[model samples]
Target: MGRLDKLPPYLFSAIDQAKAAALAKGVDVVDLGIGDPDRPTPASLVEVMAAAVADPAFHRYPAQRGTPRLRQAIAAWLKRRHHTVVDPNTQVLVLIGSKEGLGHLPTTCVEEGDNVLVPDLGYPVYGQATLLAGGEPRVFSLAAERGFLPDFAELEKLADEKTRMIFLNYPNNPTGAVADEEFWKRMIAFTTKHNIRLVNDAAYLEVVPGGEAALSLLQVASPSKDRVIELHSLSKMFNMTGWRIAFAVGHPELVGDLGRVKESMDSGVFNAVQETATYALGEAFEGLLAEVMDVYPKRRQVINAALAKMGVEVFPSPATFYVWAKVPTEESSIEFCGRALEEIGTVITPGLGFGTGGDGWFRISLTASDESIAEGARRLEGWK
Candidate 1:
């Protein structure tokens, strides 16, 4: 009777139910289910926001695309970080958060019958948006055999006349896989050749640890006939998830279309939030990012070590704050998560929640405190 009825059940809620059941039984739950960072926003940024909120100018409606100061800051950060140049006036549109933009972008480019290429184990919003926009979602498999990267050959084979968009994420979610410059070049060439609009969800772009940084999809070339857009969020980088601030940047026409959607759907991100985000996107904020990143390496090591001691295998993720591990037993992903809650009092995201390609895998967020992560791993070791 309704389009919302077609959507699959939310995975996080199901996991939460199991976690609640464990808590009801008086179990001490070490939750690693969601990717929300546990750290507080840096003191300096908090101070800036507190001061900005007192200004009457910030109380007014913000520019639909974003404040000019925020857009300029984003542009400067992109150029400094990725060697990519973009016009603040035409190529940038701020989002309430990347999720808000990601959910609405499909409606701008996709139609009732178009086919959108999506990663099999990608963020669920990609596929859900496609369906909500009355478009078809064709899953592109990401397998361990290929280091969890997409197979261009397979994607080409799967693409057809109806295909209109391709969604990619690097420093990917749930899997922690990353793409290199050469990979970006190939993806650009492939999308250009096929004339499909390419959208890169770069939410975790700045989260890479002890590895080469992820490249912006815009690094390749300017838009000639084909289009490319990227969505970047401050949530993971600045521990500003609750602030709901981000931006989409790329081809001018595509960015404008996305802006039009924003204009029609809502007023815009609050001016006060944009003022603080301007400070967060500045070059000086890298010091805060460095401090936040320092916490992840040790946390990752403790979790990986615990998994190894339990006779389970998992490669420490070079990027992102998640640890993706193959399930040691043959249990289904949901069943494995349920059993972890029942046995070890630990809560993790079942891989199948990402997509069927993740059937025998599970994801753990490094968003918990180091002590909590170590204890959760220790409990799993006892279960093993």
Candidate 2:
């Protein structure tokens, strides 16, 4: 089968269709499905981009592996935020967005018949990328009983000589599960023993509204020494989702390999966007991030309280702008979420849209506006 034929349907498209149907019926819908932030990019960054766009230097084809200044800024941010150090020249590669980097990563290492380990309940890109790279994707369960972490024993059983890489997302999508330092240490040891490449999608790493910063894999394993890489984005950090600027940092060789794949596929991020990102990571970092993150904690509280009133069981975590909860009724996640939209005119994500392992769960995104969150919560409270 062709690579495209091997892939499953894109989940969010189905959700969008349902939402559109509800809207067409003149139902007032409060969409809490997709995780795109409803806020605008920080004004400071926008102003910088406006000026940068007029610079003749940035109007060219742009630097293939990011300009020196942006790579240096990314390295410095890693040191300041995660307390990790990497060589700006060799260990950093700018991406159009973390999603694009992730889509290209499997091509760098996987050959036909090789397999990559992917979470059963994860961002769909992981497995899809593997298929596109002509590699098999082996599923690893992230059970709620185990706090949505993979069991090492289960991993050992699934991996074999052909296993090439493992994809992980902490401060994870859909589940809001953050991996602590101890978990990173164990993962590094396991992957090292198996001689497998390790990749962590750290897009939501800085989205912690709970005050305790999330740990980066680089903090535990030396990317210079280990076969590891972490992809970080400015999308969530600065409300720059549409800007499409992120970077990958890790083993110099791995970073270089991904860069090679990107060279053939795309021309790299717009230089103006990269400059704006550099500014975002520089002096404006703290204040702008604070402004972006300040809203999530209260939004989370609103949804959590409403879910509590409805007697829904939530998988508690303060990491991402997502609330993962069990389906209160006997229905599957699809049925429960469908009923929620039809009966209450509120949209929540079905866990089955993520994977079969997510069948009994549902996800609520805190990315909606305050008024929308309030309305959605009100509707959910009356749902049943």
Candidate 3:
């Protein structure tokens, strides 16, 4: 509690507290405000974790840099998924979760007062990570007109000598916007020119439509090979959120630096959990990924169709399971979310919770059961 008021009420926490209050009052809130995957982890992976627990070695401290097998698995998975070969010993490092890896990178890379380019309407963690790392988070707005992509011309001008890192998320969370190959090349050039590092969050990589995806900073084919690192999560795609299995892959030096910070932080995640992730990686979902991805669009349609009936025009969200909707009339997002939950028993995240650029919009998650999604939609019909 020592001068730690540097943060805002991150979107999910406020909604979570409200959900708890409603549940306490015997109201059945469907709890769609958070982006957590509601799907269960595949049973096959659980069996491997259970087996690993029986090994005495797993009972000992796991390696700080993860086990060789786990690292190999991560490299293998990256090669399989992205068609990019990452050296397991150098270009890969296992994280407690991608969040922790991301949270610590600023500390490892940025010195005090160094600027980090952050997205205005992207994941809250991108900014928080910069702040916690004692770096300046120079937010570049993701205007709706630009399809939520940052104006690099403006951002490029902002990146003077002090900027050290730039965060990019494709299949972006909350906004669900994807960038093209040109976007990757533009950023790679900018980072290369400025001698800054770029961190790409590929958390939603496997959830893209028809399995057609965007380019990653790590996949930019730079000869220096020290320009970018991509963070991947096993959360949404594999339903492994609680397992905390994630990794960073790219420049050997960059991954090595993050690995040193990680080594100082903790030994590693549960060896059993790492083993489980290894097994899960083998089951790539292949074309099945697109099939799984189809569910999100259907849920989006359901909630959006209902919102349309209530006269709320939703914006296109191509990747993550989110729908950005302008609150009906001129009601503020916080006020609208409050009234919706109290009167309609439906909950959502306010736009202001994301950042200043998100003030006029609210995000509805499509990651829950379709029935629950439809019910959430039906609740919106009562808004008018």
Identify the candidate with maximal TM-score.
Answer: 2
Which residue pairs does candidate 3 place in steric collision?
none
Model 2, TM vs. native: 0.99
lDDT scores in order: 0.86, 0.93, 0.79
Between prediction 1 and prediction 3, the one with superior lDDT is 1
Best lDDT among the predictions, by candidate number: 2
Model 3 misplacement above 4 A: 1-3, 9-11, 223-226, 283-294
Please state the error at residue 14 of candidate 1 in Å. 0.9
Q: What residue runs in model 2 are displaced by over 4 Å at the alpha carbon?
A: none
| Candidate 2 lDDT tens digits, 64-92 | 89989999999998899889989999999
lDDT digits (tens) for residues 63-86 of candidate 3: 778788888988787667667887
TM-score of each: 0.97, 0.99, 0.93
Supply candidate 2's per-residue lDDT for 307.
94
